[model samples]
Structure formats: structure tokens, C-alpha cells
Target chain A: MRWLRYLGYALGGILLAGCVAFLVAAWIYRDIPAGVLEAKYTTPASRFLNVDGVRIHYRDEGSGPPLVLIHANFASLLSWDDAVESLKNTHRVLRFDMTGHGLTGPDPSGDYSLERTVELTGRFVDALQLEHFSIGGTSLGGTVAMHYTATHPERVDRLILLSPGSLEGRSMQRAGRAVPKAADILKYIAPRALAEFMLTSRFGDPSRVTDKLIDQWYEMWMREGQRAAILARLRSYSSADIVKVTAAIRVPTLILWGEENPQAPVEQAAELRQMLGSAPGVTIITYPGVGHMAAEEAGPAIAKDIQTWLAAPTVRQKESVPP
Target chain B: MIAARPQLLSLLLLMAQAAAAQTQPAMDAKGWNLDTAPQSKTATPAEPPSTLNMRVYKDFDGRQQRIGDTSYAVDVSAVMTRCNDGSLIITALVIGGQLTPLDNHCPTTSK
Candidate 1:
């Protein structure tokens, strides 16, 4: 009977400790809704529109032909500010906070797969009455852009991939066996420091990762439902359809890389150009000391190149079945 | 105007294109017009047929091809140029091969 009482006491103590830890985490890592975030973060350029049941936050600027830019994972439309400032002078640059990131928050449909992203992008473009526009994106956005161009070759005039992830080697994109309920656990414990660490690690020049950049990233992460949505996106992500599509893209493709990109090495650019087998011709550009965030890190350079590419004739591309 | 210098330079280049000894293949335009041969799904065993990165000595008129000769221009090269403002412009009938720069014009301080 005494032994039984002792076991009961031990279990009670463990429960008490767990409850305390949960309370602390719940307080520190609580999600903040979009309304609160928008009040603090959005600028004069910010515009909101509902696309695929998500009230997407986007910005449209510049004046020439339409160019739609998608941001990286854990980043917002603001990520392309430097490039957009220069591009707007000659082009209509449109950037959106994707379904799970920035002020857009999460998709009500509860879907955050790359395919879901492509579908959302198409509907968004159609909603805006864009008959045809050039498309470009970085990292996760890069993957989505490539997926979109592959499937909707007719709709895209041009395609740009800035340090896109694992299109050639899907196995390497998310290596290691799945840890059960890991994403579930992550939903409850995101720290701003981790965001800072991740951003700095991806940057070719960490000195450029200012306090404002980290704050913007963390604020987006803290947006209500976003942390969970991001985790869901990573867990549900698939590059299974990429290889076939990469081979099917017939439009002129541009592959840009930062020589020091840690996330997707510069070598991957060569692999991607080879992957762009069907693309009539692929242009590869490497910024000597840039990194994964080339758009942010080397904005003017990319923008000028984009301007030149856009001015060129539309290279007729092959259509394919991919989504 | 995009920039006075670029605009002026573009006009000069246009003039140069008209006067150049070889007036680009009659079928061609401003940049090399990419051929209509579409790339197949299994582009692995055999490389797609296109002249990848043949440098254009001068920029011409794409519309000239559109209005006159063929469906689209065929001889295309992906061209990346560094502008005076330190910006870059990449031109193309771009498609295949490992994209190494056809020419790198790094600015030197001395004349």
C-alpha cells in the first residue's frame, strides 16, 4: 500500500511539472492574429485580396509589364523590397505574402502543399485579370513558380528560379526519416532566436541580416495560425512532380544562384540548367558573394537582368500536365 | 525615359545593327530568334536542338521578324550585360547547356 502511494505521488509530481511547462510555453509562444500584425507591419504599398479563400496580402508597383514574384519560406513580400524599388520604375512588380507566411496568415482550406500554392497562384492571377505575366520565386516560392510554369506553360511568359530547392534531388530536400508528431510539437514552441539563426545561416553575408529583417520574419511567424501552417507546409511538401515538369518546361528559363548559397548550393544551378532540358535555352547567373536570398541581397542586379529578359521576345514553350 | 545613357546607347546599337557588315541572317531579329523546335519530355538521352549562348554582337529588332519573315526568330543567345548603373540585363533566345557567360566585361579604371 505504501509502495502504491509512492508511485501515485511520483505521477502527480510529473503531471504538475508538465502543466507548468505547458503554461509557460503557451504564454511565450502564443500566436498573434493578422489584424494585430498588419497594424504594426504593413506599409502604404500593402493591399489585401481574397484568393482561394485566403485573404492574401500583396503589393503591386512598377509600371511596365506584369511580373509576379513569390517570396521564400518564412519570408514575406517585403523580402523583395530592394529589387521592387528599382523594378517598379520599368515594370509592374507584384509580390504577395503566400498562404502561410506574412500578413496572409494561413489557408482556411488547411492545405499548404506546393501544389496548393500553385493552385492559389493561378486563381490569384486570374482574379486580377492578368492574361499572361512573367513569374519568378525563391526557395519554396521558386519551387512553386517552377511547378506553375510547368503546368501552365501557356499562361507564363517567362520563368525565373532563384536558388530553388531540391528540384533535381527531391530525396535530399527533406532528408531523414519522419519524426512522429514533430511538427505537432513545433507548433507549440517557435522562438525568435531560431528565426534569426535560420536567416543568418542562409545569408551569404550575415552582416546584412539587420534587426528589422529578423523582426519582420519573427512577426510573420508569430501571426496567428502561421506557425502551424508553416509546419504543415514543410511536413506535407513534395517534389515528386518536379523532375518530370523540369524536363517538360520549354520556355526560356533563367537560373540564378548565389555563389555561397548554403541552402541550395551554387552547383545546383548547373544541375537545374541540365534539368531545364525542355526549356529552349536556360540562362544561368551567379553572384560572386551572394546567398539564397539573392533577390534581397542582390536586388538591382537581378532586376536589371529581368528587365532585359522581359524585353526579349516570348520564346514559345511546350505545354505539359503538371500541377 | 529608363535612363538617358541606356536609351542613347540603345539607339546607337540600333544604328550599329543597321550598318554592320553582315545584316544578321534575314530570318533573325534584334536578339537571336529561337527556333520553333519544342523540347520533349525525355530530354535526357538527347540534348534539345538550339544554339545555346551564341553572343549577339549587336541588339536588333524582334518585331522585324514578327512582321516579315517567320513565326519567331531562331538564333538566340542568353545575354547578360552590366549597365552603367551597375545593374544587369540578361537577354536571350535562352534554352540549354551549362550557362557560363559568353563574355564578362568587368570595368577597369584605366582607359
Candidate 2:
């Protein structure tokens, strides 16, 4: 009887300890103040446009032919900071945070589907009165760009895809299936630490994962409703849906793939080439030792390739189309 | 034992309370808000691509049978050729019966 009482005490103590630990973790990892993130991330060039009840945060720089750039999942427009700098001199560069990302906050409709993103892109272009423009995207952004061009072929002149997501490959198919489940689990657990691990793992060279970069990403994730929005977006993604629309894109496309991309494997570039083979102009370039974040990993080389491709006769002719 | 039962019941109740508190939604934090800004009536663009471009591909059935004396195979569905200068060219099997020139090098032929 005494032993039973001791066992009861032991069980109660263990339960108490676990509850305290969980409470402490939840408090510590609660969303950081939005003001703190804005102070750290908002730049002088930062501007906002109201698009379909979503306040889009964007940056428009330089002067020339208009070029719209979109970032990958869990990344903001700042992902294209280097690429924008490299291209702004010769081309008008526009980069914006997609809905549910960066400071854009969550969509009221809670529709983070690729179709919603495509619609947002179109509205954004229309808002800017960009009749004919070139578009580039990385990762999920790449997938969005392909879908955008497929639907609005007349508006998009050239398409630049860097490590675009695909369902054709076994690895990416598995990733597509795994992401929503992972996001569901992550939304309820310790998100910041897991997100940091994920961000670091995506880089081929982990040394590139700087403290400042991690801090920015962590702060962005801490934005109110950002976590839920990310989960919603992840849940909405369908690689099979993307693979289908990508084939119909008629604009000139330049695919820059990292040789060792883990998330969207390098082999998908070949599959993309096959899908976009019917497009009038298709150029595929592979960087020998880069990873998924090609825009950040190989910015200079990518920028140079993009500049050359944009200036090429094929793209120039396409750019001349009337609004 | 009666006294111990009362103590045990209290401990169990406390444990249940702690578990409930811990499971509460994190969004209910005091300062958190949805941060809704002034709504804008920016004209929504025309509906974007809603349907998938489900183009069906003709399935080819065969094993690794060679296509004549050339380095191409019926099963492989790829052609390999060695140039006069020792360069090699390989063809890709395009779906939908379209064969585009794939500018990739063949490692086997190069060796």
C-alpha cells in the first residue's frame, strides 16, 4: 500500500514536470512582437500595395524593361536582394513577398493555393500596369511563375525558373506528399527551431547560414498568423497540378538548376526541359556545386545568365508584344 | 489511506489543470492580434489557370531491343551518335511524339 502511494507520487511528479516544461517552451517560443520584425527587416525602399484586401510588401528598383521576381516558400522578397542589385542596373526589377509570407500577413480568405498565388501575381502586374514583363522565381516561386505564364501567356515575355518544384521525380513527389503532414505537425510544435533546421539543411554549404539570416527568418515566422498561413500554403500545394500547367507555358523559359539541389533535385531540370520543350525558346543551365537557393548561392552567375538571356534575340522579340 | 486518497485526488486535479493550460492555443496570447489593415478594393484580375494541363502521353512497350546498327534502342528510346571529332550526341525521348534535340552529353559514348 505504501509502495502504491509512492508510485502515485512519482507519476504525479513526472506529469507536473512535463506540463511545466511544455508551458515554459510555449511561452518562450510565442510569436515575437511585429514591431521588432519590422524594425529589423523593413528597408528604405520597402513599399506596400493593396491587392485584393492583402497589403503586399514589395520593392521596385531601377529603370528598363520590367521584371517581376518572386521568392520561394518561407522566404521573403529579400531573398532576391543580390539578384535584384545585379539586374536593376539594366532592367526594372520588382520583387514582392507573396501572401502569407514576410510582412504581407495572412490572406483573409485563407486561400493560399497556387491558383490564388497566380491570381495575386496577375493583380499585382495589372496594378503596376506592366503590360509585358519578364518573370523569374525560385523553388515554389518557380512553380508559380510557370503557372502564371501558362495562364497569362500574353503578359509574360520570358520565364526564369531556378530549381522549380516538380512531381515527375520520386524525391520531389515524396517531398510534396510529406510537406503538408510535416507542416501540420510543425504548426503545433516548436516551429522556430524546426524551421531553422530546415532552412540550414536546404543550403549545400551550412556555413552560409548566418546568424543574421536565421534571425530574420525566425522573426518573420514570429509574425502574427504567419505560422498558420505557412501551414495553409503548404497544405494547398499540389505538384501534380503544377506539372500539368507547366507544359502549356509558351513564353521563352530559362531554367537554372543547382547540380546538388536536395529539395527539388537537379534531375527535375531535365524533366522541366522535357515539359517546356514545346515552348519556342528554352535554355537550361546547371551550376556544378550549388544547392536549392540558387538565387542566394550563385547570385552573380545566375544574374549574369539572366542578363544574357534577357538580352538574347529570342527574349527581346517576345518582350516586344503589345499589352 | 483515506487522507492519502484526498491528497491523490487533489494532485490528479492539479495535473489535469496544467495539461489543459498547456494545450490552449498559442494565438490566445495577450498582445497577439490578426493586425487587419484598412481594406482596399483593388480590382481582382481575371481568373487564372484553374485546371491542370493533363496531356496524355502514349505509352511505349518494349524491352532493351536495339534500333538497327545505330547506338539507339527501342526500349531505351534514345539515339547515341559519335561525331567525326570524337564528340557524342544523345537524343531524348520526348513525350507526345515530339523529339527535340537535347544538348546534353552522353557519358557512355564519351568514354
Question: Which structure among the candidates has the greatest TM-score?
Answer: 1
Candidate 2 segments exceeding 4 Å error: A168-185, A188-193, A315-323, B1-111
Candidate 1 lDDT over residue span A1-323, tens digit each: 99999999999999999999988997888888778999997888788998768899998886888899999888988889888888888878889999889998889999987778889998888888888888999988888888888888998878888888755337555465453675576677788898889888888888878899898899889898888888888777776667687877877777777777877877667557656656765666566567788887778777766666666665443211111
Q: Residue-wise lDDT of candidate 2 within A207-243, one digit each (tens)?
A: 7767766766777777877888998887677655655
Against the true structure, what is each candidate's TM-score? Answer: 0.73, 0.70
Interface RMSD list for the candidates = 14.3, 21.1
State the C-alpha RMSD over the true interface residues for candidate 2, after superposing those residues.
Answer: 21.1
**Alpha-carbon lDDT, every model:** 0.67, 0.63
- Tell me the tens digit of each residue's lDDT in model 2 across B1-111: 011133322322332232222332122122211121011222122211100011111121222232121212111112222222333233232222233334444354222
Worst 10 residues of 2 chain A by lDDT: A314-323
TM-score of chain A of each: 0.90, 0.90
